[model samples]
Target: MVTEQHSFITSAKRVIDIEAKVISALASRLGQDFVDACTMLKNCKGKVVVSGMGKSGHVGNKIAATFASTGTPAFFMHPGEANHGDLGMLSKGDVMLAISNSGETAELVNLLPVVKRLNVPVIAMTNSKHSALGQHADVVLDISVEKEACSLGLAPTSSTTATLVMGDALAVALLDERGFTSDDFALSHPGGSLGRKLLLKVSDIMLTGDDLPLVKHDALVADALLEISHKGLGMTGIVDELGVLVGIFTDGDLRRILDARVDLHTALVQDVMTVGGKTTQPEQLAVEALNVMEAHKISALMVTDEARKPVGAFNMHMLLRAGVL
Candidate 1:
């Protein structure tokens, strides 16, 4: 007499154990066809057209996206749509990869004649080697599983998991074969943090020109404080008359002056400026600028060009706004 909760937990554990064994068995069955499939995809002169029905269609879409981002050109087409004008998407020299656990999905079989007339090579992912789609493919990737996790053995569970892992294995194999780099991946994901690290430049977010809060080196300390207030970055840059950065003045220095009884009204900016403050390049990434500020225990840095002129300024606040932080 197990409680309902106990029965639920036991059933879940049994499913987990069964699925784990299925995946482990699948891993050991990888063979030459895996390599051959990767090679075919990498060398395909045209797109890799992936098609399937039901749950297999969902996995096909993800596998196509992975292939496209990693250097292979691919797209997922619905077999159900092929009869409705989408079959025109197929072309000669293209490779068609079809996914069906039983390899007998009616909609997939319905598209085979059109795919053949278009002269596209077929790669089939299926559990049955004698299934219609399997017999027609140039390469057959066997994603067979002994049994599903379903107690009734009617639902798709272990079989779908094996297909997903096998698809990922194919994608990674092609990625390595094509020498796909992180830069390539970042290009496809420019809005993500990885894109900020790779594509964003200091110039993209730094303050520049009239926006710079700067005071002359010989300016009185009161004038430097005024510049800081005008800039709103809680700091001001001190530059030589030549517009070359000489030092930086911050709220920290203003506090130190008050503590020392120094007269802000009469003191020259040069007397309190921190010389050679941390700086970044206009071409450097905003993400790198953030790292430098965090490491140096400062919130601001001057952005310089190749000539060491103070071209721009930035602080941690700006980085957060730009999503670099």
Candidate 2:
């Protein structure tokens, strides 16, 4: 058992070391060709069509997704499928990103003449620039590695990693050049937590109108407590005669008043409340509101308008329920 475990650890470490070296060497190989590829992709009016065979096809799928999500329109096309009428997906004004570690993939090479005839520029990822795929490409990105991380020296391990990294470099370069923002990325990924964080606003989750926990500044601490309890927001907003928010009264304040032996019946809620408490606008992002709550160590906040009037209110529980926590 010990011998098997030791052998497993040794093999894992060796693979990691070799792959890490291969990735590190990629930086030194990036030059004018990388820049030209980025320029071609950025200038392309149509979508980026990525094609490969076998294992390279799998990597191409992910690379295409990264490109699509980062503001660069792209999609993967299996070379085998393309040969069977799917080649219609490629069109004028589009760019071809062909991945083939060997640079001699028969399925991919056969499509070169068709791709070229359509006037589409080809950017090739290969181990040798002198190979057939490279010779046909407008720009050749060398993804060469000394050897595979596979002990048999035949599997596509380090070479695939290099190809994936190169794809990432191209995608990110185009993303940066186009000035893609988080808002753009969020639009592409609208079904997950990331989308909610970027797309949800305080107005979308805040308790408005009748749900707002609000009381007159002249109200007694006892009255404020009643409002807090009725609203179940753990806090109540204290507003002045003009209906402008002036302070906040929370459970924490009640505990402090109890300790001070203040008369809840007669003490004005404004006197004991936190003056000018933390506030957020309806237009603010929920994540930004959460940041304010966390930074101030508070659990609730009053959403105010331009006139400083309490228009809405919410607490940590509301944020959690809205998936903003």
Candidate 3:
């Protein structure tokens, strides 16, 4: 007479252990068929169309997105919807991957006749090679397991885990075959911080034109400091009359100049400035700016053109605002 709560907890741990072993065993079953599946996808001229029913459909959708973001170009289609007109999403050049733990999902099976008429390649992902979907597919990837994690063996825990692992194995194999790079992945996920770090360019984040804190070298130190304060970037670029950078004046230089008792009003901006100031090019990646800031231990950096003319300025705060830090 075990309590229901105690029984549930025991069953839950057993569920986890069963799925863990199922995933471990799947690694040993990979062979030439896996290589053949990778080949079909790499040579595909059209998109990879993934289909599934119920729980397997949910995992298939995630797998498709992973494939697309990694340069494999894929999308998930619900087989139940295929009968309702979503089958138009497939093309002769496209490869369709159908997922079903039992390989007997009626919705998936109903679409197979039309899929065959279109002459598209079908890769069936199923636990039973003799199941309907597996029997009809051009290539069958066996995902069979001895039992489900559920004590009643009715829930899909272990089977779904194996299906997800198989999908990831396929997606990663294709990604490697295509030499998909991190920067390529970043382009598809621009809203995330990792994407910003990899894809964001300096020009996209840099202040430019009138936003630049620029002052002539002959101006009084007080006037240049005013520009720095107005721009709110803690530093100002000291330029010659031709608008070329001659030097820079930061809060640090201002402190040293004050220590020497230099008259703020009388001193020329050039005399108190830090010459040949550290700068970044507008074409550089924003992440590179982070490295430069770290290396120099500086709070703000001025963006310059190839000719060293000031174009923009920013500090660590901008990185936070951009979600790139």
TM-score winner: 2
Q: Model 1, residue 294: displacement in angstroms?
A: 2.6
* Model with the higher TM-score, candidate 1 or 3: 1
Model 1 alpha-carbon drift over 4 Å, by segment: 1-13, 191-197
Instruction: Provide the lowest-lDDT 10-residue window in model 2.
Output: 316-325
C-alpha lDDT (0 to 100) for residue 211 of candidate 1: 86
Candidate 2 regions off by >4 Å? Answer: none
Candidate achieving the largest lDDT: 2
Collision pairs in model 3: none
Error of 1 at 259 (Å): 3.6
What are the TM-scores, per candidate, against the unseen true structure?
A: 0.90, 0.98, 0.87
Q: Model 1 residue 154 lDDT?
A: 82
Error of 2 at 109 (Å): 1.0
- TM-score of structure candidate 3: 0.87
RMSD of each: 2.5, 0.9, 3.2
**Per-residue lDDT of 124 in model 1:** 94
Local accuracy of candidate 3 as per-residue lDDT tens digits, 1-325: 5698898888788888999999988999998878888899898999999999999999999989888988888999999889999999999899999999889999999999999999999999898889999889988888888789877888787888899999899988888878888888898998888998998877888777788888998999999888988888889999887888878899999999989999998999898899978889877888999899989998888888877878888888988788778
lDDT of 1 by residue, 80-166 (tens): 888798988899989999999999999998888888888888899999879999988888999998899999998988888888888
Q: Give the Cα error of residue 221 in candidate 1, in Å.
A: 2.5
lDDT, residue 197, candidate 3: 94
